[model samples]
Target: MQLNIFELTSIYLYITLAACAFYLAIMFFQKINRTRGSGVDLGPIFGLGFFVLFFGIVYVCWGYMHYFGYEYDFHPLPLYKTGILMTYFALIGVVFFSEKIIGKTKFAFTFFSIGCCVYGIFFTFTEFDLRLFTYITNPITVAFILISFLYFLKVKTTGEIRKQMFSAFLCYIGFLIFFLLDIEGIKALLPFPMEISSIISSIGVIITLVYLGTIFLRFETFTEFGWKDKLRELYIIAPNGTTLFHYSFIRDERNQDLDLISSGLTGVEGILGELIQSKKKLKIVDHQDIKIIFEYGEYTTIALITYENLRIYLPKLTSLRVKFEKLFQDVLKDWSGRIEVFRPANHLVNEFFG
Candidate 1:
């Protein structure tokens, strides 16, 4: 079977629309489940879902128009423009409402949504005049992509959200690059046809959609870690002066050896978890002045205490005892309060006894 470029483009667009519809439906239901009992705002899910549905339908219509060669009015009147604006308003309402409801970053969502709204309005007016609209919307879209990319990059400091945000950032950059390359002026400079540019742009869009879908599906996983994890770690390591440990030592409580604290240090928690597990003894020197001491092998590492958690991993075992002490001292020197580190007076005896 032979297929023309137009047919292939339509097929791709249809597939994209179908995937988007399924994604929106799933997210809508998930949001509904959360807001079922309480008097929570359903605007975000409703708005987002509505926009997705509407956009999908519009694309389908466009596809049909292209396939059939229908002389459809691409441009709309002022009233129709108002209706398009309403769609954007719905999107904005949903983004803001959902951000508040879900306790996500508001600024990021607001900027991206508003950018989309502005672009939507631009497209609405320029439908009848592609040349004018192309000039305006292309630059505007590129600017939005850059802004969104930066925002995602900034919010990605936390390890949990970093991967998804990075993926999103790549998508935006990809789109921006494609648009820049596909412009008539740029195409003239390039040897290859513009079709290659479209393919690359489409791939970027696909990646962006996948990342967005992953984020929606794994909302809990991408969210920042609450204070509970820190509190729990602190509670467990209270007996030990060293509240923080290397990432290699922390183990889940289930696998922890009741008789040997070191056993708990070997399991899979981050650096902080391992430190709490590795320490032989823990004590609070003064309640008013929080301080922690850990006895590891033949050295005692002391630290002035703070709520901040610490996780470090020393990959090598040879001469680890000295390395651990030096690391602890380095940390102490950076802090404001006084901290001390001392080798055990009877090092040989301590080593022999242990």
Candidate 2:
């Protein structure tokens, strides 16, 4: 039988949403499959990716069954119950990942798993409830969004990455809001039918996630390649060849001459500037297994020392340098001996390099 315009539109909408989700899912999985890296665990990303992938597949299935079964046979969709359950399973990866980044324990997602199993099995016997979908997805989506936003909020720096993160935040908030528009209070603002808004909500979720995935992929590529694990220390050097503050990534009690390292770096610009007599200056120093990356600021210099294979982290390193310089601009001018004032900078160190 021929379908009405509304049916055809929904079929197209779901297909489009599914395509976007699959593209994002493939992109993330391909990154993992291509190589193993030593950066922060990407297990959370795997979970979030699966969330998108499963939902994408679910949309396709929904489109098919909504056309065939619901539109004609008036039957329940039992397969979608499994799809929803699997999507919840993907969030477990996110909980562990979020904890590491936010450095906070959240037990809510733990409960979400229990709810997913119980509710999923219970609902397995019933028909797919479009009205209940918002009630189910909103809680977890809001939680993840809050966790990620908090992680970025704790950082005391700004630049291109921060701006991009803001965009991601807006997209996710839009995703949540689209789902919420079904409520009477919110429905007035958009005034679209619930059916169209639900499609919009799914699209919102997929598009926002893909946007975040792009940012994560670039940063995680180096991190996964050992940038995070290989990192050893960050040193904030005063203009007068003194160590203002230092942060060690790994717990190493071994005594080392950080002051000497600071003193040696004091002339790096002058020496390299004199030799080349050019605007370009040397930034990285490689000695055996250790590589030192430097970022210069008006008040002081930031030095990051790491083990081999960490080719990049300059954006974060630059962010650290910016925060430290701004935080200690006055102190650097007077040249005080007390390092206590710089102690607060440890938060900046951990935010970027922790």
Candidate 3:
């Protein structure tokens, strides 16, 4: 069947969108594997992957409807509803990432996300009413955008992070605006010649790709961690000076001698405690180019090696120790000398350090 000029342009744009969504989902899922132990949260990446997977399906169905359904008056209601439903999950992924990348987030943003989740579930079961659509979206979605944007704006951070944040903001804002205008009455109002809205919506796909690249780069270079400089390794050593676990920040290399050195340091800490030292365990000791900061727990000592003094990260270290002890409290009391028992602590390190 022959199509009009405007319909053809829209078909092309929506097809482009479908392709972008498919690739975007692949990118996020690839990043999920790529970013392991890199201290970037997987929750957001997982959420986005799910979002784009559904998004691609949504657009594919829409494209099919546009191309063939024009004559038949067809609407793929179930597919559309399912895709729209995933929008709530998309916000969940972005929100999880935002708190870490942006700053301490307001409670309202989370509340709005939960509210949208309810709306999404509700809409999926019931037939959509445009009268209800605008009313449901107007207050909540708009406020969610504003509240999230304003919170990020007020957060004080480095120039580099802020630039990336703006890129994220652009991608997010563009997607929401495009999503809002996607309904029948509003879509019909667009200029029939070029279907400018479709073209603009396609731009959001580009923005999303760029934003994802920036996030991947930031995690790779470890520059996103403004507070850390040359973080080398983390070791959790038992009180008996056996290395329970060792995690290296940089990939593809491990210092085998660190176990011996850490054992010796534990010895030194004990010796110094006895020789002209109070019972206080040595917290930090300086080497030529690296600083070792240790946090003592009832069952273990947590050692972090870095180029710069990380006394400032003591709170995180302390928190890790607390959580680890709680998580492994029973295991510690019965304390098998086996080091593998504490492998779960790696996740705690990612959470606190990331």
Candidate 4:
């Protein structure tokens, strides 16, 4: 029993392709499940499906070359032609779909994708004409990578969307690095054989796919937080529930003036007030909507408020007088179960009035 280099390469290529295909399938199904009613345009999924298919074909060709001992160049014949065309088309689909689904960043990516396609076509015909396609794709890839990096940095304030964008930016960086290596013939400078170039490029491809998968899975996590921020801003004009107000005052009289109150504070107000007056120092053993985990002198409360409810509830508690009274009651209850009996001072009201 003996194993030749060709057989070994063929086995490795088959294993890699199988792994990639399995991973892509998992991603595809996950996207289908998550995006079913998300209102996102479906173009990216279609484009990615095609891209994956073409990539599979490339791997199949590589496996065949290894098995048959064919003297095939890296970018050979019909595979090269079809692969380049499909790659460009799929990339264009991704750009258009991303722009439509996510807000548009710049049209520069569109032009860059088109340029890559044109250069790729030239390379398919010219047979590893590195000077032509590499020159065009290298600069364009680098430029897009830089642009996306900056865009992500600017917008990645806080949230899942920021994380996805950052991941995509990292993928672009990997893409740029591998591409530059290819363009500068740095792989040739290495002592190992040129096949290592393919391995390096495969790493970039894998990273890009992983980033895309994360984006597809976590799109809601990214965009929903932005909506939450906007809702929070609008909540400033809203009224706090009675319960929320009482809690605020129980916490601190000053908190009433500051308008720091929860939206769902209505129901718990009476109960909290009783507890505060009694000086019971009660710990919430178990509760729903809001959980109070109290031990010793410290109290922790976790409230679950939906985005819709928060938006709807906040505006009703608009008057400064109402907010202040609620906050005072909440603060009083919070501070060692001691109730405070004091009205806002006349001059203080006029100067630092709500």
**RMSD to the hidden true structure, all candidates:** 12.3, 6.9, 14.9, 10.7
Candidate 3 Cα errors over 4 Å, as ranges: 38-40, 99-115, 118-126, 130-135, 178-181, 191-196, 203-218, 221-354
For model 1, residues 309-338, the per-residue Cα lDDT tens digits are: 222111112234455445555544454332
> What is the Cα-based lDDT of residue 5 in candidate 4?
62
| Candidate 3, 1-354: lDDT as tens digits | 567676677777777777877787788788779867645446556655766666666676667766665545565666555555555555555554444444455545656676766766665455455236535764565565556655654553234455665666676666667665555656687775335555565566546654654554344322233444357788888877888778888676754875697798798778878996696779887776777888998888998887666334678789988998999999888886777888888899888775
User: For each candidate, what is the lDDT?
Assistant: 0.43, 0.65, 0.66, 0.45
The residue-level lDDT of candidate 4 at 162 comes to: 54
Question: What tens-digit string does per-residue lDDT give for candidate 4 at 121-153?
Answer: 764455356345645564654455466446545
Model 2, 1-354: lDDT tens digits are: 676665577677778877987887887788777644544356656755665676577667666755674367553456556545555554544554454455445656556665665666665455445337535664765577576665664462244555655775676677557535424345456767645655566566556666766766665432332345677888888778788888888886478797987888767656877988888656887776787888888877888888753434688888888887778878877865999998999788878765
Model 1 is weakest, by summed lDDT over 10 consecutive residues, at 309-318
TM-scores, all candidates, are 0.44, 0.63, 0.54, 0.53
**Given candidate 2, what's the lDDT at residue 203?**
60
Pitting candidate 1 against candidate 4, the one with the higher lDDT is 4
Global lDDT of model 2: 0.65
